[model samples]
Target: MKNEPIYLDQEENELLNEIENGEWVSNPLSPQERQAYQNNAKYTKSLQEKRQTTIRFSVSDLAVIKAKSKEMGIGYQNLIQALVHNYAVGKIKLEA
Candidate 1:
């Protein structure tokens, strides 16, 4: 049996060429640093997990949201998600 050659995208091909040309250097991390990185990755992955919920919106507000999202070249749900995430992370503040 023979194995077929794998094709790589432009970025992947460039990385492979650099590796083959000895342009890459290895810098091993310490055990503590590695563990810290692993933990951080796990936390980041958890933060990215999504759950679905329902919310009610007025027809006019929803229409405006859809129009704005379309103008921005994104879905209204994505715009809402970004807005919620920004507010949750304190990037968008509500004046009270």
Candidate 2:
């Protein structure tokens, strides 16, 4: 799926420019904010768990997967992982 480009308004652009220029000073977060941040970090980390493995694919097959991965703006390994996971979960089926 293609994502529409986000067009930032003038105010938003100015805020980005200000941050890039280092004019905005960031303050330390409150205790509540820190706790919320830590919780979020742990949750995100859990969702990102992955293991490394090696596999061989024919050059043509790899080319197709790589092309689709580039179009999806994700690493080819991630694309392969999702494809395998979907097939395992019956989200996708092989015709043959």
Candidate 3:
């Protein structure tokens, strides 16, 4: 039996139209470039893996963190994680 044509969502149909209009260009990756991208993806995934650990915070610090996190519309743990990540990636720095 022949299958009926699948319908495209609005976004998908727009993408198809763009391709048909030559708005999208194809740039095939070389084997070395592909391997580099795969390695980068694996490293990124490794960085994203979470591990649990205990940390002792002062009552005042904890309160401030919670207040700031609330203002930012995120949990304090997420703010902490972002801070740590930024430090690790050199986006944040500490004075000696």
Candidate 4:
């Protein structure tokens, strides 16, 4: 005999279908999962060291960069270095 369609109240049925289809995924990480990810990230980030360097830029460009740095909550020098490094590694795209 064919099985009867499961009659679930709205809330139960809504999630029930997703559970069966394997599409239901947790939106946020649990505390243990979050801690594991954080530990791995901390180690990865710690593997790098800061190096000091200097370069010249146009006055207006420096002013704009400083303003952008303030907006991004980082120092102007750090922002410039990040932009240069990202460009060098091809992680960031520059539009013509």
lDDT tens readout by residue for model 1, 1-96: 269888899999988998999997788999999999999999999988999999999999999999999999999999999999999999999999
> How does candidate 2 score on lDDT?
0.93
Instruction: Tell me which residue pairs clash in candidate 4.
Output: none
TM-score each candidate: 0.53, 0.47, 0.53, 0.44
State the lDDT of candidate 4 residue by residue for 1-96, as single tens digits.
478775789989879989999989879999999999999999999868776677888999999999999999999988988898899899999899
Expressed as tens digits, the lDDT of each residue in 1-96 for candidate 2 is 279887899999988988999897778999999999999999999977987888999999999999999999999998999999999889999997
Q: Which window of ten consecutive residues has the lowest lDDT sum in model 4?
A: 47-56
Top-lDDT structure, candidate number: 1
Off by over 4 Å in 4: 1-50
Model 2 scores a TM of: 0.47
* Regions more than 4 Å wrong, model 1: 1-44
Clash count, candidate 1? 0
- Candidate 3 has which clashing residue pairs, if any? none
All-Cα superposition RMSD per candidate: 9.7, 10.0, 10.2, 12.4
